[model samples]
Target: MSALEAARRRQSWSKVTPEAPTREQLLPLVAAAGRVADHSSLQPWRLIELRGEDRIRLGEAISRVRGDDEPSTKPLRASLLIAVVASYRPSEKVPRWEQEAVASGVAHLLSLLLDEAGWGVIWRTGDYTRSPEVAALHGLGEDEALLGWLYVGGKPDRSPGSRRTVDPEPLLTALPR
Candidate 1:
């Protein structure tokens, strides 16, 4: 399919089946995603591919932090989670925000690629985004931030419905300077 067509067809798939991407498959996906725009060629992003027992361990951590609201099926549902970390090594050449933008771009491309490969992906981040404990688990430095946890799996029979229409003109427009 054409690049525009592939992007337009991308959708948010919530309910996923049992299938999950292997480590080998993820390497290329991550590599392709890392090509996103980086203001200073400072590819300030890292990915932690959690699978097998690792996913359950992460769910346990989430459960510990969540107390009562912890979803019992989190471990079962999220068999593979790709944690996107934004690494901002202090750079005098470029602003920190620009570095963060690079990380966001990486996550965006990764999500699109996963969806195109017939997999469901959900980018999740809450209190854990700022949690030191969680950062330690992912080996994040002081200047780093946890952008999101990308939950991936096969698209289930019943999943989150497609997004409704929105006026394009208002959302996208070039302002004359």
Candidate 2:
């Protein structure tokens, strides 16, 4: 499928099979996302792959940070979780916000690539994403912050159903004469 078509059809799948691609298979796709636009070539981002018991550990930390939400059980929902971390770089030309934007762009592009590869994917984030305990578990550096996670697994038999879209007329604006 064409890139635009792939993007248009992209949808988040909440349910997925237990199967997932290996690091060897996924690294190439992840590498492709590196091509995302980055001002000053800062490349202010990194990804941590979580599987096996690591998910359980993350769940526990999330449980602590966000009580009564029952998010701890979420880690096990997907076969794999790719943690998106914004590794800020000191640049006079590029501010911190721009760096974070670069990281976010990478995550979005990566999600698109994962979906193209027939994987079920969803970018999950919450208030607890920046919690101290959760950051510690991911071993985030002083200049780094957790953006969120891409929960990925094999696609299920069912469709994702229709997606919600907004009209472009309300969002577009022209300069006043």
Candidate 3:
């Protein structure tokens, strides 16, 4: 599919099947996604593959942070979850914000690629993202920040509907002469 069509078809799938692409299957797509524009070629990001018991572990941590007696079912919504992390690297040329944006671009682009490859996906985040338990679960470093988790699984029988278009009239404008 053309990039335009791919972008148009890519929408968050809140619910998905119990099947997801394996790490071996996702490597190529992740490689392609990593090609996003980075100011100084500083790939200040990494992905953690969480499946099966890993999700359950994360769910437990989330539950604990939320003060819930029961484990959270949020992490179990998908068969696979890719933890998106922004690893901040000090650079004189590229600012921290730009690095973060680069990391975000990788996530968005990967979502598009995953959708094109016939997988259902949604980027999920919560107030507990920065919580101590959650951070410890990912083994995050002091310079790394939890961006979110990309919940992935097989698409349901029904096709995904196109997303609504955003009006650009107010959002885009040319510089004044």
Candidate 4:
């Protein structure tokens, strides 16, 4: 399927197996997202990959913050976990929010690319995303903030169902005369 077609078919898979793409298989997807529009070319984003035992560590950290014990499998739904971080840079022309938007765009592009490649992915975030403990886990800098994570793995055996068609007519508008 074409890239756009694949994008149209993309859906958030809540459950995925332990199989995932290797670094080699994922590099291209990462590179594809790098081409996203950046007003100042600040590239205000970074990715931290979590695999194997690291996923468990993340669950432990979350449990620590919540004051409860979470299952080790909680973070293991997907074979790989990619923590997307928005690292804003000092810029007079570009506002911090815009920089963060650029980062978010990159992440969406990455998820689209993964979906196109027959992988299941989900963009996950919550209150813990901005927590200090979570930030420390990824070694985020002062200017960096955790946006969310991408849980990715091979597509499951069951069908993902048909893509929903969205009409753009109502959402579009031309400049007033």
Candidate 5:
């Protein structure tokens, strides 16, 4: 299948196995993801790779943020957790929001790439994702903010099901003369 076709077939697999792409396998994909439309070339984004015991620590932090003694198993669902951080650079030419959009685009691209590579991937975000405690845990800078976490692992035995089609006409608009 073509790259776009593979991307379109991509589905978020909630239940995945522990098998995941190695750092060596992911480096090329990361490089491609970084080649996004970065205005002013600010490169206003970064990624934090979490694995093994780190996931456990993150789970604990998440539980603590929720005031629970028991740690969450959410982070353990995936073999790898990539923390997408939007490091906004102060720029008069490019606004912070635009920079954030660029970061988001890069994330989407990465997700597509992972899917194309036969890896089950999901982008998860919640109130805890934006928690200052979580940010500190991930070692994010004061100017940086968490976008979300990309949970990646091996595809489950079950199929991802068919891809749903959506019409874009309603969401499209042109300049009115």
Candidate 6:
């Protein structure tokens, strides 16, 4: 499919399942995603692939942080998940923000690819993204940021519906000429 077609299809995806992709399939998708534009040769992104019982471990961590004695059905919904982490090791040439942009690009590409391949994905982030205990669990220091968690799975027994459109006005920024 054309890039335009892919982008159009991607805009409508929601309701991801718990059916995670195999490691073999996941590795290539991630590689393709990382090939996006980086200001320099500095590869500043890392994906923590979680599957099976490991996903359960993360859900526990999230629940612990949220102080929810009950584990939410949300975590168990995915057969696997990829924690798209932004490891911004500051360098004189590449600013910290640029490294983060590169990371975001990687995550975006990864999500688009997954959605195009007929998999369901939701990029989710909340207060947990900055939780110190959560950061340490992922081997991330205070300087780094948790971009999001890509919850992935096969499209469930149902077909996904139509796309949701956003108003261009709020999304657009008019620069003063």
TM-scores of the candidates are: 0.88, 0.94, 0.96, 0.91, 0.94, 0.86
lDDT tens per residue, model 6, 1-177: 877888777743356564667889888888899899997778888999777777676777777789999754555667777888888776889998899999999988998998877788888777877887567667886667888788888887776776676678877898879
lDDT of 5 by residue, 68-95 (tens): 9899989998989999999999999999
Say which candidate scores most in lDDT.
3
Candidate whose TM-score is highest: 3
lDDT for model 5: 0.91
Worst 10 residues of 3 by lDDT: 158-167
* Segments in model 5 whose C-alpha atoms lie over 4 Å from true places: none
Deviating ranges (above 4 Å) for candidate 1: 67-75, 174-177
What C-alpha root-mean-square deviation, in Å, does candidate 6 show against the real structure?
Answer: 2.3
1-177 per-residue lDDT for model 3 (tens digits): 999999866789999999999889999999999999988888999999999999999989999999999999899999999999999999999888898899999999999999999999999999999888899999999998898999999999976666788787988999989
Name the candidate, 2 or 3, with the larger TM-score value. 3
Candidate ranking (TM-score, best to worst): 3, 5, 2, 4, 1, 6
Model 2 segments more than 4 A misplaced: 67-71
Report the C-alpha displacement of residue 69, candidate 6, in angstroms: 2.0
Displacement of the residue 103 alpha carbon in candidate 3, Å: 0.8
lDDT of each: 0.79, 0.91, 0.93, 0.88, 0.91, 0.78
**Backbone clashes in each candidate structure, one number apiece?**
0, 0, 0, 0, 0, 3
Task: At residue 137, give the lDDT of candidate 2.
Answer: 98
| Candidate 3 stretches greater than 4 Å from native | none
**Regions of candidate 6 where Cα sits further than 4 Å from its true position:** 12-14, 166-175
lDDT score, candidate 2, position 113 = 90
Model 6 is weakest, by summed lDDT over 10 consecutive residues, at: 11-20
lDDT of 6: 0.78
Q: Relative to the unseen true structure, what is the C-alpha lDDT of residue 143 in candidate 3, on a scale of 0 to 100?
A: 90
Worst 10 residues of 4 by lDDT: 67-76
Of 5 and 6, the candidate ranking higher by lDDT? 5
Q: Can you give the lDDT of residue 107 in candidate 5?
A: 91
Question: Candidate 4 on 1-177: residue-level lDDT in tens?
Answer: 777787777788888877898999999989999899999799999999999889988888888777786544567778799999999999999999999999999999999998888789999987788989889989999999999999998888987666678898987989889
